[model samples]
Target: MEQDVSLGLAIFVEHGREREAADFYGSAFGARQFQAHHIDGALAGVEMRLGATVIAVAGANPRREAEPSRGGPFFPKVAGGVSTIIQLTVPDIDGCFAQAIAAGATLRDEVQTDVAGRRVASLFDPFGHIWVLIERDASAGRRAA
Candidate 1:
């Protein structure tokens, strides 16, 4: 038998913007920041609470930004240098997506209903963080996503 382990997701934002990212997520998810870490008096990371889920945000690090052999600023060649996709379940899909847009998020896709009967939408925050709003039909005896 294999041992099971819990996994946590972490996202890195550009340097000097960890706090902004965390706050943006807080507003978008209607959550709050419960912890934060700093390096040399500058915010290096933050952990936000969304109900029972916690997501970590890390500050930009040149060492991890681009090709090490190519040297610093590891920014991606195109948009969204990151690889993490954050999905959030909200009571109202439209309302939550609108709130995110009002908070400076760029709409990437409008809400669409899938065959599974779930409403989903995508957007990018100012820092280029990707997010998806999910609204599952719990009343259909389904659980939240």
Candidate 2:
């Protein structure tokens, strides 16, 4: 069944960490890869779906001074850290958060209700992407405000 994806996210990791990122997402979030593009037996790009969201993982484009108009000279958040956060709306925030931690994600914020009353938790993936796991089910037990 083909999904009519309206919008998509493309994330670029450090030049050779594409496979690792894809694999991590798969194990931690149960993402299923729909396609993987390779170059000379090396993984170049991958497309996967986590529920309704389509996420594309790829290696950062090489930094070239001449190609100033290129889509990226993208760099992974190794030092300064990234401002983008990949938020996953899941049915089991606690379980998923544990899985991500076991899969090498460093816990950033423990699971708690945010100011907006959403049950949320955040972490930094090994590849340096920040992920926020959110459980929006009203029955999931939000703290009394």
Candidate 3:
């Protein structure tokens, strides 16, 4: 049985950097990478599976110097700040956070845990993206927001 409609999220960055970002995510989250789309000898879109969730990465827009130009490479002309975020849940939040930092992510805030047993973190990736990582407590079913 297949559903008629499905929802998905895809993040587009610099043209040439799409594959790079996908690689980073694969390494960071221990996900398997499957090529979804490619353009100009590079990955334009990729699918990464972290556990049961699928995350997508794609090139925003690429303008070849030879191929009739379309503005100044990339589209929408995003500002310096990021507006969207990719949320993740991992077994080891600290370890994942450290690995992300080592892989060029800036710490957006200190890891905070409320007395109710909720531990979470926010970070900005070097590749023009943001992420919120949370750790699940094995003993507890849910943590307070």
Candidate 4:
């Protein structure tokens, strides 16, 4: 079998309520609920479509417990390293920023212009994931081309 080079991105969260967390992400990103399955008295998995990307959510399998003394070294105490940030390229950075803030995300930075002449803003979701929204001016594309 040929090895697949592309792998889907998943953010493993220690969620106290899986359904709520999934719904929050879905609403925040304007994503549709692709799939949600429950099994053996726990949330088995869920998939949400963010633009063309699919994000999977799964309950922490208690059966695969790690040693109590083996603390996570790479991950931050508040936000895990695995989920550094997710960037969303949109047509309206300001609009998306307003929507995300209204949906419960804290504003990390105000919309600012970059050297590339794109407007961008950074925000943090309730789940501790950072999201950077970028809006590239249409004229910039023409100049580049």
In candidate 2, which residue ranges exceed 4 Å CA deviation?
1-5, 64-73, 140-145
Lowest lDDT sum, 10 consecutive residues, model 2, at 71-80
Clashes of each: 2, 0, 0, 0
lDDT of 3 by residue, 28-107 (tens): 66767865776656567898777776777777654442353544333223322555678888888999999888877778
Give the higher-TM-score candidate: 2 or 4.
Answer: 2
Span of 10 residues, lowest total lDDT, candidate 1: 71-80
Q: What's the alpha carbon RMSD for model 1?
A: 3.6
Candidate with the larger TM-score of 1 and 4: 1
- Give model 2's TM-score versus the native structure: 0.82
TM-score of each: 0.80, 0.82, 0.73, 0.76
Poorly placed runs, candidate 1 (over 4 Å): 1-5, 66-78, 142-145
Q: What CA root-mean-square deviation does each model show from the true structure?
A: 3.6, 4.7, 5.1, 3.9
lDDT of 2 by residue, 64-127 (tens): 4236586564755572277678889988899999999999898889999999888999998888
Across residues 1-145, which tens digit of lDDT does each residue of candidate 4 receive?
Answer: 3564544666555534567668777777687778887886668668888877788865554444354355432222353234467888888887888888888888788999978777988987776677889985777689999
The local distance difference test score of model 4 is 0.70
Model 3 residue 103 distance off true place after TM-score fit, in angstroms: 1.8
lDDT of 1 by residue, 80-119 (tens): 5556677888788999999899888888789999777789
lDDT of model 3, residue 54: 74
